[model samples]
Target: MPAEIALLFWPLVTIALYALSRVLYRHYPSAWTSPLLVTPLALIGLAIALHAGYRDYMRGSHWLLMMLGPATVAFALPIWDQRALIRRHWAALLIGVIAGSALAIASSWALASALHLDASLRASLVPRSVTTPFAVVVASDIGGVPELTAVFVMITGILGASLGSWLARLLPLRSSLARGALFGMGAHGAGVARAREVGEEEGSVAGLVMILAGVFNVLVAPLLAMWLR
Candidate 1:
């Protein structure tokens, strides 16, 4: 295939794969058995087997990535739609988001330091629990590699999806709302989705918390990075 045609072809292939994954996910409800997990790995493995470099694949795929910012912004619409609930619990929700974001970064940094991860890796890891687009920008601003930040975000998502529910249960949380907020703030989108499956109230709280956390992370992570440095 011509280079230009390949550029167009890869993105279409990725979209088809994503659609197929969603279909499969409907059949396999377990986090460990998610099609999101299976499909991406398959596509990546195929890319490797085909000898397609990351840069070449990214040339097409980056268009989807670039839409992340706008998609994130669109999440605000849901928050707006739920403004009444937000107003009613604004104080507690604010406190929960702040506390969750702080714990997510601090705990990761502490663990990474104890594990003897280098400073750059530590910086990347600090924002791992936040959403990927925001985390990548924060990592870049902090002198960490955006690519590394993205990898960490994926790892965090997978771990959160697999263990977050169990961990939420283990915590001394009284309110399902708070539990969901913590999950979303600390685990990003995947956690929010999982919270939705758990319950409607949990899902609503999680969605609000995820949006708040993403906005807060984008605003605060660079400052935290400076302090870490």
Candidate 2:
């Protein structure tokens, strides 16, 4: 195959696989059958079977990656639509988000240190609670491996989405806002998706919390990284 044709094929195949996975998960929704979990595994298996290289796959997948920016920005619309609720609870939200954000950073650093991880690994771990693009940029600024940071962010999101509902039930959380905030702060976009599954109010608040948490990480992570260095 010509280089251009090969590149094009990979992206198309990836998209088709993702669509199939979504359809499968939608029809058979189980914890283990999540599209988020299934799509990646399916892609990896296909890539191995096709003997596709990561660089080539990424070349084809870049378009999908680029779309993430706009998709993230679209969350702003929901936040704006829910502005009244946000204003009514701004103080509590801000305080709660900040506290959660602080703990995320602190616990990540402490755990990495306990494991004797290097500075690079610690930097990558620090922004794992936020979205991928935000985490990558922040990780890069703080002298981390952007690739590793992206992986960490994805893992955190998947785990958050998978466990959030169970944890919510197990905990003493009495309010939708509280549960949503916890999900958003801990898991980012995946958590927001899970929250949406629970209720519109939970989803909306989770989206707001995810955005706020991203902003907090962008502003604070670099300073913390510098100090730790």
Candidate 3:
């Protein structure tokens, strides 16, 4: 295929793969079978099989990347629908998110330091808990590698989505909102998807929490970076 044709075709191929992964997940319904878990690996394998360069794949994949910001902002609609419940617990939610965000930043820094990573790499890992769209921007602003941040975010999401339920059971958490908020703040979109598996209320709360965590990290990460430096 010509380069332009391949570039145009990759996006459709990516979407088809993702859709097929979702269908498979519905049939299998296991942690490893999750669409989020499966799709990226499939894409990587497909790319390797085709010997496609990252630069070319991204030429098409950028379409989905471009949509990420708008898609994230659209979460507000669900939040607006749940405004009543949110208002009732606004204080608790705010406190929980702030604490979670702080912990996320601190823990990432500590781990990176323990691993003896360089400053830029440490910065990239700092935003690992936030969703990729937010994490990439934050990482760039903080002298981190945006690509590395995206990788960390993906790994975090997959692990969180896969293990979160089992961990929750181990913790014996009683509140759906708490569970949702933790996962949302810690794991981002994949966690939100997993939250939906529990209940609509959990999913909505997770979506809201994910948005809130993103906003919080955006505002706080740069400042923290400066202070840590």
Candidate 4:
């Protein structure tokens, strides 16, 4: 294939695999059966079998990454639609965002420090519960490895999805809105996705909380990093 045409090939292939993974997820219906887990594994295996370098694949795959900004911005529609609910729960939502963001950073930093992880790793882990784009920027600002930050974000998401449901139930809080807000503020995008499965009201609250959490992290991480230093 010509070089220009070849450039599009890998990206198309990745998209197809992702679509297939979504289908499988819908069919399987297991907590472990997430497209995020399956799609990357399938792509990595294919790349290895083809002897394709990760760098080369990334050159094409980055198109998908670029869309994250617009997708995030689009979430504003949901927020606008739910403005009434947001206004009603503004105080609780604000508290949840602050507490959740702080807990995420503090928990990761303390654990990593206790385990004697290097400074760079600790920095990367501290932003793990925020959205990936914000996390990457925060990690870079703190002199952490963006690649390591991405890995930590994925780990945080998986842990949240797996355990958040049980944890929410254990809490005395019976309001789905509050429960979903807690999960989204603590887990970011993955928790919001899980919240959608619970109910529409919960999902709307989750989306708003996730957005607030991202904003909180971006605004506060730099200050926290300075304090830690």
Candidate 5:
């Protein structure tokens, strides 16, 4: 196939794979079936079969990534909707985001260090705990590969969602606030989905916490980048 046609086709393939993955997950609903897990694997397989490198695929799909910024901004509406709850639990939400973001960064750094990964990989790992849009921004700011950081974010989210569910069940996280915060802090987007499966209030709180954490991480990323340098 011509390069131009291949570029266009790859983007469609990527989108179709993701859409199909979501459908499969809706029906078969498990960690392995999750779109975050299956879409990437399917895309990788397709790309490999087509001899398409990351750059080739990204050339067409970059627009989707650009949409992330607007999507992240839209998260603010959730905060506005939950203003009353936000006012009541301002301290908890604030403290939870701070602590969660810190721990996530520290743990990623330590894990990368322990593995003796390169500095760029370490930087990519730093924002692995946050969602994609924030992680991509942080990655670029901190001399990490945004694409690599996005992959790490997906892996972290899948694992976090799985573990967050288990923890919610095992731990005495009785309150909606605690349960929602637990998933939001632990898993971000994936966690919010799982939290929604549990309850509406939990879903709302999780979404708020996830947005707050993303905004906080984006704000702190510059300082963190400088410190690393």
Candidate 6:
């Protein structure tokens, strides 16, 4: 393959696979069909078959990662639409964010400790519960590998989204705010998408909660790191 063609390959393949996965999900609607699950796996398989290096694959896909900033900002539209809901439930949202962030950090710490991971790996795992952008930053600030943190974030998201779905069904979460917070706090970006699937209000609340959690973690991260030290 020519240099230019090779550079474009993974990005093009990623976009096409994601689109196809979305179509499959809409038609079939199962965990197996999830674009979140399918697209990356397909890309990995393709890359392996073609003997593509990780650096080359990333060179093409970095642009897509940049889009996440705009996408995260776009979530503000939903949050703005539900300002009344937020105002009415400010106390609940505040409590939930605080508690959820604390628990997530604590659990990450415990998991890493149990595994006896080194400090760098332990730091990377600490911010796995938040969305990628936040996790990446937090990991860096705490002396972790940003790239490894991103992978952990994705894994955390898939698991959290799945767990949130199961809990939503099992628990009697009558309020949209409650349901939204459940996924948003647990899964971050993936949870927000899943919350959106559930309802507009749920999605909006989930977006708001996810944003809040991200911001909270970011602001507290420096202090948290110092305290841990």
Best by TM-score: 5
Best candidate (score: lDDT): 5
Colliding residue pairs in candidate 2:
none
Off by over 4 Å in 4: 1-6
Model 4 clashing residue pairs (backbone)? none
Q: Which regions in candidate 2 have their CA more than 4 angstroms from the true location?
A: none
Compose the digit string of candidate 6's lDDT tens values, residues 1-229: 5568878888998899999999988999875677878888888899888888788888768988898788767767866877898789999999999999999989888888998998888888888878887888888888889899998888878888889989999999899989999999989888898899999888888888988898789899999989765
Against the unseen true structure, what C-alpha lDDT does each candidate score? 0.82, 0.84, 0.84, 0.82, 0.88, 0.86
User: Could you tell me the TM-score of candidate 5?
Assistant: 0.94
TM-score per prediction, in order, is 0.93, 0.90, 0.91, 0.91, 0.94, 0.89
Per-residue lDDT tens digits of candidate 3, residues 1-229?
A: 6788987788998899899998998898887887766888888898898898889799867878899889778867877888997898898789988998888888988988998999999989988989888888889888889998998998899888867777767886789888888678877898998888888877888888888888888888678768877
TM-score-better candidate, 3 vs 6: 3
User: Which parts of model 1 have CA positions greater than 4 angstroms off?
Assistant: none
Q: Which of the two, 1 or 4, has more TM-score?
A: 1
Write down the worst ten-residue block by lDDT for model 6.
71-80
Ranking by lDDT: 5, 6, 3, 2, 4, 1
Tens digits of per-residue lDDT, candidate 4, 1-229, equal: 4456557978998899989999999999675778878888898898788778877787767888888788777867877988998899999989988988888888988999999999999988888888787888778877788888988888788788768888887889879878888678767788888888888888888888888787778787678768866
Residue clash pairs of candidate 1: none
- Flag regions of model 6 displaced more than 4 Å: 169-174, 196-200
> What are the clashing pairs of model 5?
none
lDDT of 1 at 209: 84
For residues 45-128, could you state the per-residue lDDT of candidate 2 as single tens digits?
Answer: 987887877787888678887886887678678779989989998987898789988898889989999999988999889889
Q: Which 10 consecutive positions of candidate 5 have the poorest summed lDDT?
A: 1-10
| Cα distance off (Å), candidate 2, residue 58 | 1.7
Of models 2 and 6, which has the larger TM-score?
2
